[model samples]
Target: MQLTITYFALLRDQRGLDTETIDSPAATPAELYTQLAEQHSFTLPSSALKVAVNDDFAHWTTPLKDGDTIVFIPPVAGG
Candidate 1:
């Protein structure tokens, strides 16, 4: 399946790109992330990241369908 992935804030800096299209056999958010991390040579810390599917916040185990738009938002810090 093919999915569109977006990186925000620090995550975008780590990836060096704002968005990308990924191909994977992964069904859940966690599995897809594992594949993406390996392919992109970046570590994605699940505990510190928030995931969104099709513009809505999603759980780690949320199933991903073809053509889904996924976004990874890293933890934000401010005073």
Candidate 2:
């Protein structure tokens, strides 16, 4: 399936890009993150992030489909 992913904060810095579209065999966000973590050497684990699908907050186990837009949001600190 084809997925569009948006990276933010630490994830974006680690990935070195804000967004990307790629073909993947992952069936869920959790799976996708694991695939990406390995491919990109992301420092944070999936347990440290929240996921969203198509702009809506989604559970990690949410079923993924072709053309889905997903974001893996990392923790943020503000002054």
Candidate 3:
């Protein structure tokens, strides 16, 4: 599937980019995240994250489709 993934804050720093489009075999947000996290050496796991699809909050197990836009949000600390 061809999807656009948007990385934010910590993820953006780790990925070295804000957004990217790629072809992947992952069937769900969780799968895709796990793959990217491994490939990118992301220290934060999906257990500490939230996912969104097409600008709407989505479950990690939600099904993915071609042309979907995904966002992975990591926990943020604010003063």
What's the TM-score of every candidate structure?
0.85, 0.94, 0.94
Q: Write the per-residue lDDT of candidate 2 for residues 1-79, one digit (tens) a residue.
A: 9999999888899899999999999999999999999999999988888999999999999999999999998876788
Write the residue-wise lDDT of candidate 3 on 12-76 in tens digits: 99999999999999999999998998999999989999899999999999999999999998897
lDDT of each: 0.84, 0.94, 0.94
RMSD of each: 1.6, 1.0, 1.2
Q: Tell me the spans in candidate 1 whose CA falls farther than 4 Å from its real position.
A: none
How far out, in Å, is residue 71 in model 1?
Answer: 0.7
What would you estimate as the lDDT of candidate 2? 0.94
- lDDT score, residue 77, model 1? 82
Looking at model 1, the pairs that clash are none
How would you encode candidate 1's per-residue C-alpha lDDT over 1-79 as one tens digit per residue? 9999988886677789989887878899888877777766766577878889999999999888999999877777869
Model 1, total clashes: 0
